[model samples]
Target: MKKRNQYSAEFKAKVVLEVLREEATVNEIASKYGIHPVMVNRWKQEFVDRASEVFKKGPSEAEKALEKEQQHVAELERKVGQLTYEVDWLKKKSDEILNRKRP
Candidate 1:
């Protein structure tokens, strides 16, 4: 069995950009990169299809999820702080009561 080749995002982008430029045939690009022509074509198609995503305004889904997660963590941290303070107060009061009873 042979392992599959992995191409980086930068390399794929370069190849796709070259294809978009129409400076050479897809076959030529594929041979130069030592990859299959179909692979090159697939990358080109995917790049063209998703190019609009680069221009879209507003936060992406991943960013929104990250923000929501950060808020949740902050809320949890605040609750923990409040609980810790309450526990410390309760312990101090209990110690005072115990000391009073001993006198």
Candidate 2:
């Protein structure tokens, strides 16, 4: 089977921009660019949707803080498991010692 052609991000962006400019229809743009019309339309819509947020800043500080809190919680859960195991081991040892002395 022959491998399909892969279009780069730059090429997709260019084609989407062209479609947005109204210089050509989606079908015409796809045929001229050797890409599928459906793919071209999808990219065009994505570009239009994200155009407003393109200039916006990255994730907010609250998002970053939540990520940090998640990491801390994972670490604490791991430590709790280790401590639980150690406590179980110590309890078994104490029970064995007490049973030996009960005679």
Report lDDT (CA) for all predictions. 0.95, 0.89
Clash totals for all models, in order? 0, 0
Query: Candidate 1: worst 10 consecutive residues by lDDT?
Result: 53-62
What TM-score fits each model? 0.65, 0.52
| Angstrom error at residue 22, model 2 | 0.6
lDDT of 1 by residue, 22-53 (tens): 99999999999898999999999999898898
Judged by whole-model lDDT over C-alpha atoms, candidate 1 comes out at 0.95
* TM-score winner: 1
Estimate, for each residue in 34-78, the C-alpha lDDT of model 2 and write its tens digit.
Answer: 888998888888888878766779876677899999999999999
